[model samples]
Target: MDIRPIRTDRLSDKIVNQMIQMMREGNLKSGDKLPNEGMLAEQFGVSRGILREALTQLQAQGYIRRKPKDGTYIQDDIQSMLMNDSVNELLKKTTYSDLLDFRETLELKMVEKVIERASDEEIEEIIEGLGVADNEKVQHDMDHYFHYKLAQASKNIFFMNFIDTYYDLITEIAVKSNRDQVRRNQIAEEHLAIAKAISARDKEAAKNAVLHHMKMVDKTVIGEEGK
Candidate 1:
Protein backbone atom coordinates (compact mmCIF):
# COMPACT_ATOMS: atom_id res chain seq x y z
CA MET A 1 0.00 0.00 0.00
CA ASP A 2 2.99 2.26 0.53
CA ILE A 3 3.80 3.09 -3.10
CA ARG A 4 5.50 6.27 -2.04
CA PRO A 5 9.04 7.47 -2.88
CA ILE A 6 8.90 5.80 -6.32
CA ARG A 7 10.35 8.77 -8.22
CA THR A 8 9.49 12.30 -9.25
CA ASP A 9 10.21 11.98 -12.99
CA ARG A 10 7.34 9.54 -13.80
CA LEU A 11 4.95 10.66 -11.09
CA SER A 12 1.92 10.99 -13.35
CA ASP A 13 2.43 7.67 -15.15
CA LYS A 14 3.23 5.89 -11.91
CA ILE A 15 0.05 7.19 -10.37
CA VAL A 16 -1.96 6.14 -13.40
CA ASN A 17 -0.48 2.66 -13.20
CA GLN A 18 -1.26 2.51 -9.51
CA MET A 19 -4.93 3.32 -10.12
CA ILE A 20 -5.10 0.84 -12.96
CA GLN A 21 -3.64 -1.76 -10.62
CA MET A 22 -6.35 -0.96 -8.09
CA MET A 23 -8.98 -1.58 -10.73
CA ARG A 24 -7.38 -4.83 -11.86
CA GLU A 25 -7.12 -6.07 -8.29
CA GLY A 26 -10.83 -5.40 -7.72
CA ASN A 27 -10.02 -2.69 -5.19
CA LEU A 28 -11.63 -0.03 -7.37
CA LYS A 29 -14.39 -1.81 -9.20
CA SER A 30 -16.76 -0.18 -11.65
CA GLY A 31 -19.02 2.44 -10.00
CA ASP A 32 -16.65 2.66 -7.04
CA LYS A 33 -15.84 6.24 -6.12
CA LEU A 34 -12.18 7.06 -6.31
CA PRO A 35 -10.50 8.55 -3.26
CA ASN A 36 -10.92 12.29 -3.36
CA GLU A 37 -8.12 14.18 -5.11
CA GLY A 38 -6.78 15.63 -1.89
CA MET A 39 -6.82 12.22 -0.22
CA LEU A 40 -5.17 10.54 -3.20
CA ALA A 41 -2.52 13.22 -3.31
CA GLU A 42 -1.82 12.68 0.39
CA GLN A 43 -1.72 8.90 0.02
CA PHE A 44 0.54 8.77 -3.01
CA GLY A 45 2.76 11.46 -1.51
CA VAL A 46 2.60 13.25 -4.85
CA SER A 47 1.67 16.84 -5.57
CA ARG A 48 -1.93 17.61 -6.47
CA GLY A 49 -0.84 18.45 -10.02
CA ILE A 50 0.61 14.98 -10.51
CA LEU A 51 -2.52 13.32 -9.14
CA ARG A 52 -4.79 15.41 -11.36
CA GLU A 53 -2.69 14.64 -14.42
CA ALA A 54 -2.96 10.93 -13.75
CA LEU A 55 -6.72 11.22 -13.34
CA THR A 56 -6.98 13.10 -16.59
CA GLN A 57 -5.32 10.26 -18.45
CA LEU A 58 -7.56 7.71 -16.81
CA GLN A 59 -10.64 9.70 -17.78
CA ALA A 60 -9.50 9.94 -21.38
CA GLN A 61 -8.93 6.19 -21.44
CA GLY A 62 -12.51 5.61 -20.25
CA TYR A 63 -11.31 3.93 -17.09
CA ILE A 64 -13.11 6.55 -14.94
CA ARG A 65 -15.53 9.46 -15.16
CA ARG A 66 -15.82 12.86 -13.48
CA LYS A 67 -19.13 14.30 -12.30
CA PRO A 68 -19.74 17.98 -11.59
CA LYS A 69 -20.02 17.70 -7.81
CA ASP A 70 -19.96 13.96 -7.18
CA GLY A 71 -16.23 13.55 -7.94
CA THR A 72 -14.57 10.88 -10.13
CA TYR A 73 -15.81 7.30 -10.34
CA ILE A 74 -15.16 4.26 -12.45
CA GLN A 75 -17.01 4.26 -15.78
CA ASP A 76 -19.91 1.93 -16.47
CA ASP A 77 -19.28 1.63 -20.19
CA ILE A 78 -16.25 1.03 -22.38
CA GLN A 79 -14.61 3.72 -24.44
CA SER A 80 -14.49 3.63 -28.22
CA MET A 81 -11.62 1.45 -29.50
CA LEU A 82 -11.61 3.03 -32.92
CA MET A 83 -8.95 5.47 -31.75
CA ASN A 84 -6.16 3.39 -33.21
CA ASP A 85 -5.00 5.09 -36.40
CA SER A 86 -4.81 1.73 -38.11
CA VAL A 87 -8.60 1.52 -37.98
CA ASN A 88 -8.79 3.67 -41.06
CA GLU A 89 -6.31 1.46 -42.81
CA LEU A 90 -8.27 -1.61 -41.91
CA LEU A 91 -11.48 -0.04 -43.13
CA LYS A 92 -9.94 0.90 -46.44
CA LYS A 93 -8.77 -2.65 -46.99
CA THR A 94 -11.75 -4.42 -45.47
CA THR A 95 -14.46 -5.97 -47.58
CA TYR A 96 -17.92 -7.01 -46.48
CA SER A 97 -16.55 -10.51 -46.24
CA ASP A 98 -13.81 -9.38 -43.88
CA LEU A 99 -16.33 -7.62 -41.66
CA LEU A 100 -18.41 -10.78 -41.32
CA ASP A 101 -15.38 -12.83 -40.39
CA PHE A 102 -14.28 -10.27 -37.83
CA ARG A 103 -17.69 -10.21 -36.17
CA GLU A 104 -17.69 -13.95 -35.77
CA THR A 105 -14.37 -13.74 -33.97
CA LEU A 106 -15.35 -10.81 -31.71
CA GLU A 107 -18.88 -11.92 -30.73
CA LEU A 108 -17.83 -15.46 -29.94
CA LYS A 109 -15.09 -14.21 -27.62
CA MET A 110 -17.44 -11.68 -26.01
CA VAL A 111 -19.99 -14.39 -25.31
CA GLU A 112 -17.36 -16.56 -23.72
CA LYS A 113 -16.40 -13.81 -21.28
CA VAL A 114 -20.04 -12.94 -20.55
CA ILE A 115 -20.54 -16.52 -19.47
CA GLU A 116 -17.65 -16.15 -17.04
CA ARG A 117 -18.78 -13.06 -15.10
CA ALA A 118 -22.24 -11.74 -16.06
CA SER A 119 -24.69 -11.34 -13.16
CA ASP A 120 -28.41 -12.20 -13.05
CA GLU A 121 -29.53 -8.65 -13.75
CA GLU A 122 -27.16 -8.44 -16.74
CA ILE A 123 -28.38 -11.77 -18.04
CA GLU A 124 -31.99 -10.60 -17.79
CA GLU A 125 -31.19 -7.56 -19.90
CA ILE A 126 -29.75 -9.84 -22.55
CA ILE A 127 -32.79 -12.14 -22.39
CA GLU A 128 -35.11 -9.16 -22.81
CA GLY A 129 -32.96 -7.95 -25.68
CA LEU A 130 -33.78 -11.17 -27.52
CA GLY A 131 -37.52 -10.62 -27.09
CA VAL A 132 -37.54 -7.71 -29.50
CA ALA A 133 -38.57 -9.95 -32.37
CA ASP A 134 -41.82 -8.47 -33.59
CA ASN A 135 -40.33 -6.92 -36.71
CA GLU A 136 -37.30 -7.80 -38.79
CA LYS A 137 -35.67 -4.37 -38.53
CA VAL A 138 -36.38 -4.10 -34.84
CA GLN A 139 -35.19 -7.66 -34.33
CA HIS A 140 -31.94 -6.95 -36.13
CA ASP A 141 -31.30 -3.83 -34.09
CA MET A 142 -32.07 -5.71 -30.90
CA ASP A 143 -29.79 -8.50 -31.91
CA HIS A 144 -26.97 -6.02 -32.43
CA TYR A 145 -27.64 -4.47 -29.04
CA PHE A 146 -27.73 -7.90 -27.45
CA HIS A 147 -24.28 -8.67 -28.76
CA TYR A 148 -22.98 -5.24 -27.76
CA LYS A 149 -24.32 -5.54 -24.23
CA LEU A 150 -22.96 -9.05 -23.89
CA ALA A 151 -19.52 -7.68 -24.72
CA GLN A 152 -19.95 -4.90 -22.22
CA ALA A 153 -20.74 -7.40 -19.49
CA SER A 154 -17.48 -9.16 -20.23
CA LYS A 155 -15.71 -6.26 -18.45
CA ASN A 156 -13.41 -5.99 -21.43
CA ILE A 157 -13.70 -2.42 -22.60
CA PHE A 158 -11.58 -2.95 -25.70
CA PHE A 159 -13.89 -5.60 -27.08
CA MET A 160 -17.02 -3.57 -26.41
CA ASN A 161 -15.58 -0.52 -28.14
CA PHE A 162 -14.41 -2.47 -31.16
CA ILE A 163 -17.84 -4.00 -31.71
CA ASP A 164 -19.71 -0.74 -31.23
CA THR A 165 -17.63 1.03 -33.86
CA TYR A 166 -17.92 -1.71 -36.49
CA TYR A 167 -21.19 -3.53 -35.80
CA ASP A 168 -23.22 -1.57 -38.30
CA LEU A 169 -21.23 -2.96 -41.21
CA ILE A 170 -21.49 -6.39 -39.62
CA THR A 171 -25.30 -6.21 -39.49
CA GLU A 172 -25.48 -4.90 -43.02
CA ILE A 173 -23.50 -7.86 -44.29
CA ALA A 174 -25.47 -10.34 -42.21
CA VAL A 175 -28.78 -8.99 -43.46
CA LYS A 176 -27.65 -9.00 -47.06
CA SER A 177 -25.91 -12.38 -47.09
CA ASN A 178 -28.44 -14.32 -45.03
CA ARG A 179 -32.02 -13.25 -45.59
CA ASP A 180 -33.57 -16.55 -44.43
CA GLN A 181 -36.04 -15.96 -41.63
CA VAL A 182 -35.40 -19.35 -40.11
CA ARG A 183 -31.69 -18.65 -39.86
CA ARG A 184 -32.37 -15.30 -38.21
CA ASN A 185 -34.56 -17.03 -35.67
CA GLN A 186 -31.83 -19.56 -35.03
CA ILE A 187 -29.37 -16.78 -34.30
CA ALA A 188 -31.82 -15.26 -31.85
CA GLU A 189 -32.26 -18.61 -30.14
CA GLU A 190 -28.52 -19.02 -29.83
CA HIS A 191 -28.25 -15.63 -28.13
CA LEU A 192 -30.90 -16.67 -25.66
CA ALA A 193 -29.14 -19.93 -24.95
CA ILE A 194 -25.89 -18.12 -24.35
CA ALA A 195 -27.61 -15.79 -21.91
CA LYS A 196 -29.19 -18.75 -20.15
CA ALA A 197 -25.86 -20.50 -19.73
CA ILE A 198 -24.25 -17.35 -18.36
CA SER A 199 -27.12 -16.86 -15.96
CA ALA A 200 -26.55 -20.40 -14.78
CA ARG A 201 -22.82 -19.57 -14.37
CA ASP A 202 -21.88 -22.70 -16.26
CA LYS A 203 -18.61 -21.67 -17.86
CA GLU A 204 -18.16 -24.71 -20.04
CA ALA A 205 -21.79 -24.59 -21.12
CA ALA A 206 -21.40 -20.92 -21.96
CA LYS A 207 -18.30 -21.53 -23.99
CA ASN A 208 -20.01 -24.31 -25.87
CA ALA A 209 -23.05 -22.14 -26.52
CA VAL A 210 -20.93 -19.34 -27.95
CA LEU A 211 -18.78 -21.61 -30.06
CA HIS A 212 -21.86 -23.31 -31.42
CA HIS A 213 -23.34 -19.96 -32.34
CA MET A 214 -20.15 -18.91 -34.08
CA LYS A 215 -20.14 -22.15 -36.02
CA MET A 216 -23.63 -21.39 -37.23
CA VAL A 217 -22.53 -17.95 -38.33
CA ASP A 218 -19.53 -19.45 -40.04
CA LYS A 219 -21.54 -22.10 -41.83
CA THR A 220 -24.63 -20.11 -42.78
CA VAL A 221 -23.65 -16.45 -42.81
CA ILE A 222 -19.94 -16.22 -43.57
CA GLY A 223 -20.06 -19.47 -45.50
CA GLU A 224 -22.31 -17.84 -48.09
CA GLU A 225 -19.42 -15.75 -49.38
CA GLY A 226 -17.16 -18.80 -49.73
CA LYS A 227 -14.35 -17.30 -47.67
Candidate 2:
Protein backbone atom coordinates (compact mmCIF):
# COMPACT_ATOMS: atom_id res chain seq x y z
CA MET A 1 0.00 0.00 0.00
CA ASP A 2 2.85 2.38 0.94
CA ILE A 3 0.47 5.34 0.69
CA ARG A 4 1.71 8.89 1.24
CA PRO A 5 0.01 12.19 1.84
CA ILE A 6 -1.07 13.62 -1.46
CA ARG A 7 0.65 16.91 -2.18
CA THR A 8 -1.93 17.76 -4.81
CA ASP A 9 -5.64 17.29 -5.45
CA ARG A 10 -4.82 14.22 -7.52
CA LEU A 11 -3.51 12.43 -4.45
CA SER A 12 -5.88 9.49 -4.68
CA ASP A 13 -5.17 9.13 -8.35
CA LYS A 14 -1.45 9.34 -7.61
CA ILE A 15 -1.78 6.59 -5.04
CA VAL A 16 -3.53 4.39 -7.56
CA ASN A 17 -0.96 5.20 -10.25
CA GLN A 18 1.93 4.45 -7.86
CA MET A 19 0.36 1.13 -6.94
CA ILE A 20 0.00 0.31 -10.63
CA GLN A 21 3.63 1.28 -11.18
CA MET A 22 4.64 -1.03 -8.38
CA MET A 23 2.77 -3.85 -10.03
CA ARG A 24 4.38 -3.09 -13.37
CA GLU A 25 7.80 -3.04 -11.71
CA GLY A 26 7.14 -6.54 -10.29
CA ASN A 27 7.24 -5.22 -6.75
CA LEU A 28 3.65 -6.38 -6.33
CA LYS A 29 1.91 -9.39 -7.76
CA SER A 30 -1.63 -10.70 -8.06
CA GLY A 31 -3.02 -11.91 -4.72
CA ASP A 32 -0.27 -9.99 -2.92
CA LYS A 33 -1.33 -8.72 0.47
CA LEU A 34 -0.69 -5.00 0.54
CA PRO A 35 0.32 -3.38 3.82
CA ASN A 36 -2.71 -2.97 6.08
CA GLU A 37 -4.46 0.34 6.52
CA GLY A 38 -2.43 1.59 9.50
CA MET A 39 0.95 0.77 7.99
CA LEU A 40 -0.14 2.08 4.58
CA ALA A 41 -1.22 5.36 6.17
CA GLU A 42 2.15 5.71 7.92
CA GLN A 43 4.00 4.99 4.67
CA PHE A 44 2.13 7.71 2.80
CA GLY A 45 2.29 10.19 5.74
CA VAL A 46 -1.45 10.46 5.49
CA SER A 47 -4.17 9.69 8.02
CA ARG A 48 -5.98 6.36 8.12
CA GLY A 49 -9.12 7.82 6.58
CA ILE A 50 -7.43 9.12 3.43
CA LEU A 51 -5.66 5.82 2.98
CA ARG A 52 -8.95 3.97 3.33
CA GLU A 53 -10.58 6.25 0.79
CA ALA A 54 -7.84 5.63 -1.74
CA LEU A 55 -8.01 1.90 -1.16
CA THR A 56 -11.79 1.96 -1.54
CA GLN A 57 -11.47 3.71 -4.88
CA LEU A 58 -8.95 1.11 -6.03
CA GLN A 59 -11.22 -1.68 -4.94
CA ALA A 60 -14.16 -0.23 -6.82
CA GLN A 61 -11.96 0.23 -9.83
CA GLY A 62 -11.17 -3.53 -9.65
CA TYR A 63 -7.49 -2.99 -8.95
CA ILE A 64 -7.61 -4.58 -5.51
CA ARG A 65 -9.67 -6.75 -3.20
CA ARG A 66 -10.42 -6.25 0.51
CA LYS A 67 -11.65 -8.77 3.07
CA PRO A 68 -13.16 -8.05 6.43
CA LYS A 69 -10.96 -10.39 8.51
CA ASP A 70 -8.12 -10.67 5.99
CA GLY A 71 -6.06 -8.06 4.08
CA THR A 72 -6.14 -6.29 0.74
CA TYR A 73 -4.92 -8.21 -2.33
CA ILE A 74 -4.03 -7.11 -5.83
CA GLN A 75 -6.58 -7.94 -8.48
CA ASP A 76 -5.91 -10.67 -11.02
CA ASP A 77 -7.18 -8.55 -13.91
CA ILE A 78 -5.06 -5.46 -13.44
CA GLN A 79 -4.60 -4.70 -17.14
CA SER A 80 -8.31 -4.12 -17.68
CA MET A 81 -8.32 -1.69 -14.78
CA LEU A 82 -5.34 0.13 -16.21
CA MET A 83 -6.81 0.32 -19.70
CA ASN A 84 -10.21 1.57 -18.62
CA ASP A 85 -8.77 4.12 -16.19
CA SER A 86 -6.29 5.50 -18.72
CA VAL A 87 -8.92 5.89 -21.44
CA ASN A 88 -11.52 7.40 -19.13
CA GLU A 89 -9.03 9.88 -17.71
CA LEU A 90 -7.83 10.90 -21.14
CA LEU A 91 -11.35 11.35 -22.47
CA LYS A 92 -12.65 13.11 -19.37
CA LYS A 93 -9.94 15.75 -19.18
CA THR A 94 -8.92 16.11 -22.78
CA THR A 95 -10.44 17.79 -25.87
CA TYR A 96 -9.22 18.90 -29.29
CA SER A 97 -9.03 22.49 -28.08
CA ASP A 98 -6.96 21.37 -25.09
CA LEU A 99 -4.43 19.77 -27.41
CA LEU A 100 -4.32 22.86 -29.61
CA ASP A 101 -3.71 25.15 -26.64
CA PHE A 102 -1.02 22.85 -25.26
CA ARG A 103 0.86 22.62 -28.55
CA GLU A 104 0.61 26.39 -29.04
CA THR A 105 2.20 27.14 -25.67
CA LEU A 106 4.70 24.27 -25.55
CA GLU A 107 6.01 24.71 -29.09
CA LEU A 108 6.55 28.43 -28.68
CA LYS A 109 8.31 27.98 -25.35
CA MET A 110 10.42 25.19 -26.84
CA VAL A 111 11.56 27.65 -29.54
CA GLU A 112 12.61 30.16 -26.90
CA LYS A 113 14.62 27.47 -25.13
CA VAL A 114 16.16 26.30 -28.39
CA ILE A 115 17.28 29.83 -29.27
CA GLU A 116 18.84 30.28 -25.86
CA ARG A 117 20.91 27.09 -26.18
CA ALA A 118 21.34 26.80 -29.95
CA SER A 119 24.45 24.88 -31.06
CA ASP A 120 25.72 23.29 -34.23
CA GLU A 121 24.80 19.80 -33.08
CA GLU A 122 21.35 21.00 -31.99
CA ILE A 123 20.78 22.69 -35.33
CA GLU A 124 21.77 19.48 -37.09
CA GLU A 125 19.26 17.49 -35.04
CA ILE A 126 16.49 19.94 -35.89
CA ILE A 127 17.35 19.62 -39.58
CA GLU A 128 17.20 15.84 -39.32
CA GLY A 129 13.82 16.08 -37.57
CA LEU A 130 12.43 18.24 -40.32
CA GLY A 131 13.60 15.68 -42.87
CA VAL A 132 11.69 12.98 -41.00
CA ALA A 133 8.50 15.03 -41.12
CA ASP A 134 8.94 15.52 -44.87
CA ASN A 135 8.75 11.79 -45.55
CA GLU A 136 5.62 10.54 -47.38
CA LYS A 137 5.07 7.66 -44.94
CA VAL A 138 5.43 9.87 -41.88
CA GLN A 139 3.65 8.41 -38.83
CA HIS A 140 2.45 10.14 -35.68
CA ASP A 141 5.06 8.41 -33.58
CA MET A 142 7.72 9.52 -36.06
CA ASP A 143 6.48 13.08 -35.82
CA HIS A 144 6.40 12.82 -32.03
CA TYR A 145 9.97 11.58 -31.96
CA PHE A 146 11.05 14.30 -34.37
CA HIS A 147 9.71 17.00 -32.10
CA TYR A 148 11.11 15.24 -29.07
CA LYS A 149 14.54 15.17 -30.71
CA LEU A 150 14.27 18.88 -31.48
CA ALA A 151 13.32 19.55 -27.86
CA GLN A 152 16.31 17.50 -26.71
CA ALA A 153 18.51 19.69 -28.91
CA SER A 154 17.42 22.67 -26.84
CA LYS A 155 19.60 21.21 -24.06
CA ASN A 156 17.15 22.37 -21.42
CA ILE A 157 15.78 19.66 -19.14
CA PHE A 158 12.54 21.52 -18.42
CA PHE A 159 11.89 22.15 -22.09
CA MET A 160 12.68 18.54 -22.96
CA ASN A 161 10.37 17.08 -20.32
CA PHE A 162 7.57 19.49 -21.16
CA ILE A 163 7.71 18.63 -24.85
CA ASP A 164 7.95 14.91 -24.21
CA THR A 165 4.80 15.01 -22.08
CA TYR A 166 2.66 17.25 -24.27
CA TYR A 167 3.91 16.22 -27.71
CA ASP A 168 1.90 13.01 -27.58
CA LEU A 169 -1.26 15.08 -27.17
CA ILE A 170 -0.39 16.95 -30.34
CA THR A 171 0.31 13.71 -32.16
CA GLU A 172 -3.08 12.44 -31.06
CA ILE A 173 -4.79 15.50 -32.47
CA ALA A 174 -2.78 15.42 -35.68
CA VAL A 175 -3.82 11.83 -36.24
CA LYS A 176 -7.46 12.41 -35.41
CA SER A 177 -10.34 11.81 -37.85
CA ASN A 178 -11.10 15.51 -38.31
CA ARG A 179 -7.56 16.52 -39.30
CA ASP A 180 -7.72 18.97 -42.24
CA GLN A 181 -5.26 18.49 -45.09
CA VAL A 182 -4.97 22.19 -45.87
CA ARG A 183 -4.23 23.11 -42.24
CA ARG A 184 -1.79 20.22 -41.96
CA ASN A 185 0.15 21.59 -44.91
CA GLN A 186 0.23 25.02 -43.30
CA ILE A 187 1.53 23.58 -40.05
CA ALA A 188 4.19 21.59 -41.90
CA GLU A 189 5.39 24.75 -43.60
CA GLU A 190 5.61 26.48 -40.24
CA HIS A 191 7.76 23.64 -38.99
CA LEU A 192 10.12 24.18 -41.93
CA ALA A 193 10.37 27.89 -41.18
CA ILE A 194 11.10 27.16 -37.53
CA ALA A 195 13.90 24.80 -38.50
CA LYS A 196 15.42 27.42 -40.77
CA ALA A 197 15.28 30.06 -38.06
CA ILE A 198 17.02 27.73 -35.63
CA SER A 199 19.62 26.89 -38.24
CA ALA A 200 20.31 30.60 -38.74
CA ARG A 201 20.37 31.27 -34.95
CA ASP A 202 17.52 33.73 -35.31
CA LYS A 203 15.72 33.58 -31.94
CA GLU A 204 12.91 35.96 -32.74
CA ALA A 205 12.27 34.24 -36.04
CA ALA A 206 11.97 30.86 -34.37
CA LYS A 207 9.53 32.18 -31.77
CA ASN A 208 7.35 33.84 -34.38
CA ALA A 209 7.40 30.72 -36.51
CA VAL A 210 6.07 28.56 -33.68
CA LEU A 211 3.46 31.18 -32.80
CA HIS A 212 2.20 31.20 -36.36
CA HIS A 213 2.16 27.42 -36.42
CA MET A 214 0.00 27.25 -33.31
CA LYS A 215 -2.30 30.04 -34.48
CA MET A 216 -3.16 27.99 -37.55
CA VAL A 217 -3.83 24.86 -35.46
CA ASP A 218 -5.99 26.92 -33.09
CA LYS A 219 -8.07 28.24 -35.96
CA THR A 220 -8.52 24.79 -37.45
CA VAL A 221 -9.50 23.26 -34.12
CA ILE A 222 -12.04 26.01 -33.48
CA GLY A 223 -13.54 25.68 -36.92
CA GLU A 224 -13.91 21.94 -36.49
CA GLU A 225 -15.40 22.34 -33.03
CA GLY A 226 -18.06 24.63 -34.43
CA LYS A 227 -19.12 21.95 -36.89
Worst 10 residues of 2 by lDDT: 131-140
**Using lDDT as the measure, which candidate wins?**
1
What are the models' TM-scores? 0.55, 0.52
Candidate 2 at 10: error in angstroms? 19
Model 1 segments more than 4 A misplaced: 1-82, 95-102, 132-135, 223-227
Error of 1 at 63 (Å): 19
**lDDT digits (tens) for residues 1-227 of candidate 1:** 86767546588998888877766667777778878899989999999998999999989977889998889988764222213424644754787557656766776677778776777788888787676355556666766788788888999976776676665556665665446677777878888888888888777787788778877866765565664
TM-score of 1: 0.55
Q: What would the per-residue lDDT of candidate 2 be over residues 135-215, giving only the tens digit for each residue?
A: 323644555665777778767655555555565545544555224455446656777888888778787898888788668
